[model samples]
Target: MSFEWPWQYNFPPFFTLQPNVDTRQKQLAAWCSLALSYCRHHKLYTLDIMEAQESPVFNHKNIDRKLSMEAILIVFEELRKKGNLEWLDKNKTRCLVMWRRPEEWGKLIYQWVSKNGMVNTVFTLYELANGDDTESEEFHGLEDWMLIRSLQALQMDGKAEVISMDDGKGVKFF
Candidate 1:
């Protein structure tokens, strides 16, 4: 007797979690690629596990499979191991999707400062965050911590200096 297999039939076992490491690695890579693409396209800078609706990894409807927080953490941990993701907060709830690193951010800031003649100029942190002087396609609406860390990194390298003013609102960068 000969048996015929349906070429287009959906197999429930295909969705079942595989135990093999190689298969799991491939699955993770695909998922990460999709997640990263979605995040980048949406300009998403942070992901919150507690608030899962915004995350693409958890909002998929095709398979009726929702990723648990633990699963999401494991995948994020793997991405971190591969240097593709970074945790921005102490609780590990908010992550910085580091397609570019802090060093790169520092370099971009330095270039912008040089290009726009912002060096030797006195500006406040609030100004930097929402200033007309630094208004441009880049560095606009940049996060405070990321900007400070990038500036500090530049300062450590002797490329720039940060000066504090008496008003408690001004931080000059030169």
Candidate 2:
């Protein structure tokens, strides 16, 4: 499915950083929503600023408009502040985007496990993400880091426990 761009994405002025405080704040909010939804739809867990600039979400080819580097940085910063993004480096070149928080992912996983009567079962991280049984699940193909985080969230809730083994990491649901 094609990603749906926000109304502001097609507006020329939206590409430029607004000088007015209120307008800029609203602009950043729109940008943050767009970025998160775009990443979620594409299953993009990480973003590099350089790569993102060329992406359709940040570059509106139809309108011949693109968000400037400064504006992109500002938007990313806003996302970070909202707890939906985490910078991966001090230079702020790369970041992890979380449209669905770990806790939310954890809840989905637990629900699936409960539905399948898989409680008290031990599953390798790979099995949970790439196993045939999970192929039809929303969490299928999830990145390793994100998967681990989701399990950790479950662990916090006492619904799951993460186990480390020689081969790799595993999880046991309660």
Candidate 3:
């Protein structure tokens, strides 16, 4: 979806803890939907839970209101349980917001490899992410950690294998 804000976007109660159980549930749902849309629109793949209050959508400049860290943590926990975000650290402070899940990304890469006759080819992680040939790819310039996660997903399906080189890791699509 586009970046259209919901009618409840700027509603003051949207930022705080709700007393009623039903209201709180609805509020959490709204928060998650809003966050998903906003992050997708911005092509943001991660959400720093601790810094959310200072980030867009969470920080409301016009109303001078921001979600407290506690509120952010609560909503983030709900989002995590829904499989829309993954905790990056054991502390539950940083999250890898899965606007597009890593498994899907791995499939996309596999398709690209097949279409381009890259299967059975050994390519460094660097090449798959930043080579001139992949400049136009959707996952071009992807961060190394995220790229590895995607590759690991492929490995689970017997689609790829990783080779440790002196410089870095390489992937053999099969």
TM-score of each: 0.70, 0.97, 0.86
C-alpha lDDT values of all predictions: 0.64, 0.93, 0.86
Which segments of candidate 2 are over 4 A away from where they belong? none
Better of 1 and 3 by lDDT: 3
Model 1 ranges with Cα > 4 A deviation: 1-18, 83-92, 133-135, 164-174
Candidate 3's error at 38, in angstroms? Answer: 2.3
Tens-place lDDT per residue, model 3, 8-126, is 77788788879899999999999998998888777778777757778868888888778888888888889888988889899987888876778988998899999999899999898
Clash pairs (backbone) in predicted model 3: none
- Give the Cα error of residue 42 in candidate 1, in Å: 3.1
Steric clashes per prediction: 0, 0, 0
Query: What is model 1's C-alpha RMSD?
Result: 8.7
In candidate 1, list every pair of residues with a backbone clash. none
Ranking by lDDT: 2, 3, 1
lDDT of 1 by residue, 61-105 (tens): 555545666667777887788787888778888787755566777
Q: By TM-score, who's the top model here?
A: 2
Q: Which RMSD values do the candidates have, in order?
A: 8.7, 0.8, 2.3
Alpha carbon lDDT at 9, candidate 2? 85
